[model samples]
Target: MNSKIQNDIKELVEEQVISKEIAASIENYYKSKKGDTPNRLFTVFAVLGSTLVGLGIILILAHNWDSFSRSIKTVFAFTPLIIGQLIVGYTIIKKKNITWREASGVFLFFAVGSSIALVSQIYNIPGNFSSYMLTWVLLCAPLIYLLKSNALAILHIVFVTSYACSFGYFNGNNTPWMYLVLLAVMMPYYYQLLKNKKIHNITSIFNWLIPLSAVIVLGTFVKKSEELGFLMYVILFGLLYNIGKIPFFDNQKLRRNGYLILGSLGTIYMLLLTSFEWLWKDILRHEIIINSQEFYVSVVLLLVTLGVLIFSYSKKRIQNFNLFQYVFVMFTIIFFLGVSGSIISIILINLLTLILGVMAIKIGADKFHFGILNYGLLIITALIVCRFFDTNMSFVLRGLLFVSVGVGFFLTNYMMLKKQKGKIE
Candidate 1:
């Protein structure tokens, strides 16, 4: 009887009698008890510890405002910076395991270096702000190597870039060489961050900040001449478009998006540049303008660069191109060729606007996107309405034009929505 019961149990097990729900519960039970590390507690301690240290430093500095002599205070000011350097040196020599305490200490040293520089500036030191900032950044660089503190390195880079923008570029030289130097200094940290992809947010922040600083600093180089400035915009947009077209950049959402944002801003600035009178009258008028090779070279480079970018981004799947971008590029070339003030200029501009509006509607069939199309339609409609204003048209005919446009807007948008719904279904 015992053998028979055992055989029956084995047969039942072999016949898949157990439920999937029971197997899942068993798996989860094993997983929950595998490890008991307290990750959250460590994170809380890190935040609280950094905040307390920052507050303590602030209080100490505030309390010692007026006690020391000029020379004595200056020496004391360098004391923390010296001590911080020692700590960084010790970390490197020991090559010991790093803990949260060590990381906090490195961060504190960074603050000390910054504080020393700030105090020097407050006391009317002879150094320039950029020089002082460069000193602080150099002093903090050791912390990255010794403690492997990405945060401190990143903070130092941020301070350096801010210093450059405020002081280095403030004079409006807008030299591209400054941008090249800044990027060089940042390249090391960028490489380090890429190795450890966990700090994605930090890397993304630098990606945006670096490009923005470049654009701002480069703005000074853009001459007041509208033709020159617009040509620069074309070059800027072409660079951005080429960057966007790279296959490796496809998955980099932040980097790609940053390029798009910069390109859009450059495009808008170009449009405004076109409408400026100084570009047409002041720069393009005299024989001197025609004689200058720089003017012609700038114009040709803009056109050639834009053509390359457009050709590169054109792919089989990309059926809709940005009409505004194309219009801006074409207008820039034609204007440079000396056809800007002719009667055909107005007609071309109006056509460009209408085409862009239609392209916007095709790409984003939403109410907000339709506004571009509506705006273009309104401009054309206004022109036609104005033609009938002076001489022969009756009130009824004038009113009919207004009514017709309003109806056209409603019907076109409704049809777009209908098409969208049909696609969804």
Candidate 2:
């Protein structure tokens, strides 16, 4: 049984917050579960301990590395790999539990990379850093399935992102197209994890990781019309925003819903970036090449975002119809206008940002969510700060605007708390 659940209701009843009958029902519900979520520390420390041991072995070997003969070095190289394999194999057959599986998978993962690096060093193998990361990721990806380890899955995504960075950045003409395939291969496992109907810590991690990986790697696809890359990003974020509205993800806690968080934040950030007058001024200098690769990617992204919006509509996932969900659609028109050297687009964006913040405050108040309300206040503050330098507005007016917004923040929060107290009484 979960110890925290037991303690919580016992305390609640003592405080006269709930009757004994309700407490008993709550206790029975949890006690009837086949398995509760594992204690967080157990899995974390298990994986951490195995990783430290693996590093220690490597460090010790490096100390005596040059003193040994080629045969001795070769033996040392394979020792950890062999031991890790045996442990993982045993885990699969008998000691199949979260601690054993994650520890073994992580240990074997590091072993595979170390062994490969050692072999390359001893044999003087010729390879770049990107190629090595690719090989390492490819070899360890199966560990995600073989051991059914979420820790391994998260590590796999990290390594995959690192590989993209190595292969795509400043390297001559090397596109990391294989990254999409690698990420796709891991989706089946993610789908299965979600279908389990429990929000494990690991579930929340993948929630953030998958989108983060894509957002990081998406920049690698920029070959032409470099400025349009920003547009592609906005559209991708919009797609992510729509994806968040899906029932499976929306019903989860805010921390677990990475698509919504990242999507909303990313959109706001891009909006802030675009609101600058100089950006559009620069875009006017360069030719808006519709024939460029970035343009094509942006088109695909817009279509996909639109498709998701329509699908979400059919399913009726968003209950309140968030205005920011259509931010992509709105920005598409704004972007074209900006590129055409229209000043109206920038003004519209400022208005949009202000409206978004206001809507956020309203939503937060309705939900009694202090965090959401504050986030909305921050959004407006960000916009005002962005506009501070660009316009010819005087210092007095700007200072007045700042003072007004600051006062609004305090009053809104105070009212919200007072209302919540009234409801409680």
Candidate 3:
């Protein structure tokens, strides 16, 4: 058991709420539970070792590749693929070991890539990096189910996203619709992993990769209307933030909660950037259309976001009034105000930031959470820094503002800590 639980149990015993024997039994059960869990080191090394072996084999073959005949090179290319397939197939049919499954899946994954790369090099095949990644990821995707491997699933997500970036952003492809198809193909396996609760470290991988893929691929869906893109992002962030609020992901680590982190950061950053007059001026120059593909996408996302919001509201899942929980409403108002040429939008944006900072401080103080308190202070400091960049602000005034905010930070933190200490005593 962790220290907190151990202390609680000890207190229970002292209060005569439970006997010492019961506390000892609970501790022994936790000890046995810890012993029963698998060592993650083996799983880590399995993936690492298989990857290195695959790379080493490729390097060794490459060294003598120039001397080999076409037939020999072809044989060499297919050998790893054949061997990997056999290993994976055998692991699927007979092996129940997670380490074995992961090691074999990873080995086979690289083997397929190497085999394809070597064959392409030998035959002088013409293909882009995006197509290559797409092919590799699709081929490896089945291993997630066949081997039941979360490690391979993580790798698959990384490559699939890399393919989207390569195809859409780097290649500037006009028809990037294939990315959506491929992304959809991978979702079933992700859901399977979620259903089985097999994810551990892989959860962090998903948290980072999914948001990154969305950021990369969402641009591909934009056709003519760029302004609608902002609306799309607002809905997107709202959806992500709500997903993170779901019960399964609610209590995970900060990094593991990518939806909340990315959504909140994206919303705040977009709001801050939009607070400037030039952005609104540019938007006013365009003929705002309500019938574009971007518009449809935005509307669809908005509806989904609203659905989640309503569901969350009904469930009382959003007890805390964090910035992420309410930025969608704030952004919608700000957008309308900006379009109408009202200075009130900018004022509202600034006010929203200040309110968020103050709320964070209040919540942090109530919970005795130093991170939340610092985050609130950081938001205020960020606003001050943003103000310093404006040509309209005098250097002297900016300096005074910074000094004043700095003093507030110090005093507020000092007072909170004093209060917390007093409570402890």
Candidate 4:
């Protein structure tokens, strides 16, 4: 605590406004709180600084790589790896410091990757990006548990997810189930961190990374069953949203809650895309079904989503019973109706979007949260902007519509500000 604050507490005690006991407690509370802030900040900077230093080393080597003889190139490749391993081993055995742990972990992570790249380049190995990432992540995986480094764990997930996307999604091949095995490698360390109740930035990083990785890697599971893939995506998003609402994650900031953010945005984007009639037409026109592994996965995901939705609704756990909450049901209905070639599906989808925006505005107004209100307005504005591309609408009508919507935006905001001022007065 600062001297001024200490003096202020003493003054309160002298004036008999607070007891000596209370003043002492306040001073102790502030002292402890102030102490933790710096350690957390230092941990953040140490990891980032180490990451930059490691990357710099790799960049310097890459630049000078072509000028070196093959033997020297091989020596340089293993040099960082050996040096990083020594640092990390020393950190684990002797230092056991946060800064050392993070710095060494980061350096070792990059060392592993750069070493693999150098070796591949020297041997002229015909490996793809996916193989390169997989090798690096596997080599780095043991560091997570051995060094007990959460940052390295995060790096492992990131590189592995990248590998999955590059190999499976981009290459149009099924992602090997080995992805699950690699993820499981980090789970023991993840559980240990959670058990320790470490509410640091590392915890938040895991919360965001794991869900995001799942979302990306799940796409690779889809193959010939492209049509059923929409169902899979909906189920995946619903499950993510529900998972984010768990007691452990729900208390976190919205940005840190990856599942909630990704699920909501993904659901909204999908709904908006399907709001167009052409997509529904295409689905009905090509009514093909392939009972592949993707089909089974979709069914399982759908069942899980259905269970979660029912439980949440029954328990009244869904705080925001907005359009996002009901989107899965709405989409399922629309999918069936559209399959039968009904134009009503298109109409209902548009109506749902309109209702979502309006309800968002109502909720925002009730709560007096302008950010939420503006978000609702932005959604409506996005819908309007999209309509500008419609050939069926005349250019004059579109221009007039834009002007009217702009006026509404300005007028509504003005009214809200006036109401806020009135409330203050």
Highest-scoring model, TM-score: 2
In Å, residue 254's CA in model 1 sits off its true spot by 7.9
Instruction: Give me the overall lDDT of model 4.
Output: 0.79
What lDDT does the true structure give each of the candidates?
Answer: 0.55, 0.89, 0.79, 0.79
For model 1, residues 1-425, the per-residue Cα lDDT tens digits are 24564455456556767555654564555556544323445644663666466556656865885776777666656655666556556656776444443555554655576566647755876876566666666656555655766456556557666666655456443333343564576577667765675236656665556556556644445434434544555566645544444443434763434555565445544544444334456554433354443466466656665665556556542344555445546666555454345544434544554454456455445434555455555544645544454347887887897898888778877887777678789
Which is the better candidate, 2 or 3, if ranked by lDDT?
Answer: 2
User: Which regions of candidate 4 deviate over 4 angstroms?
Assistant: 2-8, 19-41, 59-73, 123-126, 184-202, 245-252, 313-316, 395-400, 414-425
Off by over 4 Å in 2: 1-40
Look at candidate 2 and give me any clashing residue pairs. Answer: none
Cα lDDT for residue 334, candidate 4: 79
lDDT of 3 by residue, 202-280 (tens): 6567777877678667877776887767767777877888887876677776667777778767766776676566776
Predicted candidate 4 versus true structure: per-residue lDDT over 1-425, tens digit per residue: 89999999989999999998999899999999887554766888989988898888888988887899999999999999999999998998895777778779999899888888889989898988887888888888888877777778888888888888888877656565778899898888877776675476677778778878988888788777677777678778878877777656667666677777777667766767777777767664456474687778877887888787788778877776556666777777777787778888877877777777777677768767787677677777777776566548988888898898788778777888889889999
For model 1, what is the C-alpha lDDT against the true structure?
0.55
Q: TM-score rank, highest first?
A: 2, 3, 4, 1
Question: In candidate 2, what are the lDDT values of residues 1-425, reduced to their tens digit?
Answer: 67887898899999999999999988777776636656568889999999999999999999989999999998999999999999999999995788899999999999999999999999999998889988999998888998889889888899999999889885666779889888987999999999894487678888999998889988988876888887889899999988987888888888899999999999999999888989888763366798987888899999999999888877876577798899999988888887777789889889998999999999899999999999999999999999998889999999999999999999999999999999999
Alpha carbon lDDT at 73, candidate 2: 91
Top of the candidates by lDDT = 2
Q: Which pairs of residues collide in candidate 4?
A: none
